[model samples]
Target: MADAAPPLQRLKGAMDAILVADVFLVMAGAAWFGVAVLCHSQKIEAPLQLFQTLWEPLFTPAIGLLMAAALLSGLLGWWQRRGQKRAPGTGS
Candidate 1:
């Protein structure tokens, strides 16, 4: 079997994947919101209901998860920086 990647490499890959996913989620969410707003403004009940029926149930939890992931990523970066600052022989 091929050797596994180093932990740092694996972490970097995971972070990259998350960043891509975040970008996609933001873009898709914005597009969805725009369409939703347009539908509502035009009094297009059928399309609006269709969009809501397909999107609303997942939207809340997805946003919550996205926000939580972003917060966690920021906090982790902060913690890593703080740790590096405190390591011996590492000049600030």
Candidate 2:
């Protein structure tokens, strides 16, 4: 028993894991936003048609949709886990 983590310690560890998940989700969202901006500003079009020719290809929308899904799912999962941790009987 001496080497075992106390109940409180275990609970804290679980909480930390939840926090890490939240952090990772936020970082991924930022990265996705950055990539979208990069694609929008590239020199793929002729001169003087920078903003006019955006989204000509399908990859732009596909990337945006995937990123949106990831963000939405990540937020939902984080909230669900947080609620579970705070529920009754989940004690140290």
Candidate 3:
């Protein structure tokens, strides 16, 4: 709408981006976890073992940070936009 404020529009875009990133993060983490588990059970080669070994420590923190950041961004964006429907006293 032409009446929409710039800040609210920006917040809405940010919230959408965060939601998409959250979905991608979950999918990637799950895929890596599944691979690690399968490789361990199948007695896979050294590279797979090496990947599993390296992945846990590095990816664990990364995934945590990704999810936390996405959630925080979504919340902050929502909060910023919640009361931003109008500039004060420009009556519709």
Worst 10 residues of 3 by lDDT: 83-92
Compose the digit string of candidate 2's lDDT tens values, residues 34-85.
6656765884334224333543453355455557767887998999998888
lDDT values, one for every candidate: 0.78, 0.62, 0.71
Clashes of each: 0, 0, 0
Each prediction's RMSD over C-alphas, in Å, is: 3.6, 10.5, 7.2
Candidate 1, 1-92: lDDT as tens digits: 99999999999999779767766876787687788788889886676576577566765666776788789999999999888888976566
Best by TM-score: 1
Candidate 3 per-residue lDDT, tens place, 1-92, comes to 56766998899898678657766766776786678678768876664666568666766666776778778879989888765765464753
Off by over 4 Å in 1: 6-19, 89-92
Candidate 2 Cα outliers beyond 4 Å, as residue runs: 1-3, 42-92
